[model samples]
Target: MPCWYYDKKELRETPSILDGISFETERRYRKEGARFIMECGTKMGLGHNTMATGVVYFHRFYMFHSFRSFPRYVTACCCLFFAGKVEETPKKCRDIIKTARGILNDNYFYSFGEDPKEEVMTLERILLQTIKFDLQVEHPYTFLLKYAKCFKGDQQKLQKMVQMAWNFVNDSLSTVVCLQWEPEIIAVALIHLASKLSKFTVQDWEGRQPQHQRWWDMFVSDVTMEILEDICHQVLDLYQSTQKETHQSSSPPQKPPSRAESPTAVKSTNSTVIMLSSVQQQQPPPVSGNGNLQEVNNIQSIKSLAGGVPVLSSGDAPSLPQGPTPPGQSHGYHLYHAPPPPPPPVVPNVPYPTSAWGVQQTLPPPPMPPSLPPGPSGFYSTGGRQQQQRY
Candidate 1:
């Protein structure tokens, strides 16, 4: 299926303002405090937009229902699961429980201790039904990647912009304003901040570079600037506070999500953050050595890459063919036992390559000075790097 990266008004119904639970009551429930919600939102891997929507769901659910009447954390899990389904990559139930407990333990470790895993699982079912299983919400990650690639200046400058945009995304999750804007608007704002930061970073280090303005016009919009400043200010506050506590501390035990005094049967949040914490902090005894360590390390690496534990890449790393090669470097080409299916031939007039992978990119022509003829204009423009097409 084609991946979508933005959502519009019609696709996502704007939730009406919640009134049942006054903002003050919600604030008070969190006053001991509100920051954990942001921390949990981040851990949920819902991203800024997903978290914003999830918070909206959480508030709307509670507006009519009282927090005192039923388990509120179950509602939190429901919001995240609902958002996750809406956002395409739904997290596993066990993983969600793991992370939420870890964060709660950091501050209120002693007070809250009850398993909410069952509740989270049950909530997941309800959430799926409510949204009718329509996952696939838009995210800012893709746009930032596209924007970064469009920059023609020093490669590092472009990369810095990408990184800045990512930070902007993380910061957006922490503030109330996330609830007010669409992700695309937020994305545009982030790219704008990224561009300014890129310019600033470039000027401070290497002075100005070339062709910076070529891609500048693509990002110019009134909405971009307005949201960019608002996002930047919120992100700046986050940086000032330096909220690394959630990530810094090792994952805690998978505690049930409930107050000890509460009579309700507990359910763990099963958050991925908690899973990492359990692995990192509550280290189980060594299973074995060498081979086992490599396997464990591989799992950890994939979890880190996926930003969640369960979606790990499985199967052993391929065993190397016996050949003369240096110790550290991989063989330049991999050989398979069977011949693979041939890809569709490239259409003669199209701008991109037609391979099984589809639309591969080749390096751009070498940079030409404004004054000089760069090179031969008749070079065969294949538009993609040539690979050894073995029969």
Candidate 2:
């Protein structure tokens, strides 16, 4: 079998067409990707670890495969299913297919019903060959634990950062960063950014100067600060956009003109009078009082009223920033538009289960390797046991 890593560089650096897509389009793709992962794990009744494992496997597959030819959604589903098997969690084909149908458009998702037994078997062979059968994936949970314990303040912010870091790794799979870095380094970068985002003050804020202390110097050497900076920039971009979009229109009014008289007060008073007539119609109604009504109208300008809470409704779903461009300018795919008239506010009644949106699952104890005493630095023989080995 041909090695999957033959063209790994191209996979990481090549821009997927979806990179320049609009926000809504990008959102749909994410939804598809998320759904694909969910279905793969749910099929075998596996927990979140298996789902996360699936994401890693999917990324590995795409590293060698062409995104243009293979449908990403389908590839995602295949990778997750394969990961479940490798992790010793077997799922039924029917259950996986059925669940996908329930949520996806019936017409478009019909392909799920087709038998994947043969296709999965083929993919499994390809996956094993590509990875040389290596299945061990390093997760950031351990690093997160270490960081959280060491940094006592901003526990909630640190926790959120940990989660964000985990997601950063997931997204980075589709980017160039994964090509050069090991899993441990990637984890470190993500956790570092998460800490930055939380803005948590370190325990020895003043004491741990980089050049002054050997301990601080040693800690920095274990991770790549450069990559951490890049990841931090990306994560911060997403966060800023999410914050900019405040959900409610009725947050609060600006400080009421002021306690004493000021220009703002005059402007606010004028704004009120102008809004009343403007909203009423283009032509003002005939006034009962000749001078008073005209005098009030003359003082007010409608521009201030026009500025109040301008609607930010987007035709497409919002997404994370992509490529080298500043995230403020970059918009993800916007595949579809909303109805001509704004849709009525929706109230979804179905309560979401914690597991559904991928809250971390309780992990099973990892198997420990038997102690083999000491050995040489280079590869050792299997002693004729004919067992598989992985790096």
Best by TM-score: 2
- State each model's C-alpha RMSD to the native: 27.1, 24.7
* Residue-level lDDT tens digits of model 2 in 1-391: 3232324345434334334333333332333464357444554567656766766666566555544444555566566666767677766654554454443442234333234344544566776666667786655555545544555456565555555455555434433343445555556676664345344435453235556342234344644466567654543343232222222112333443221111110011111122222223432221211112332242122222211111112221223233344212212221222232357445333433433222222322234554343335433445644333344
Per-residue lDDT of 85-189 in model 1, one digit per residue for the tens?
Answer: 676657766566566655443222212223455566666666555544545444566666665554455665566556656755644543443445656667767
**What local distance difference test score does each model get?**
0.42, 0.43
**What does the lDDT read for residue 7 in candidate 1?**
32
Q: What is the Cα-based TM-score of model 1?
A: 0.42
Error of 1 at 77 (Å): 3.4
Instruction: Give stretches of model 2 more than 4 Å off.
Output: 1-35, 38-45, 111-113, 153-177, 205-224, 236-391
TM-score result, candidate 2: 0.48
What's the residue-level lDDT of 323 in candidate 2? 37
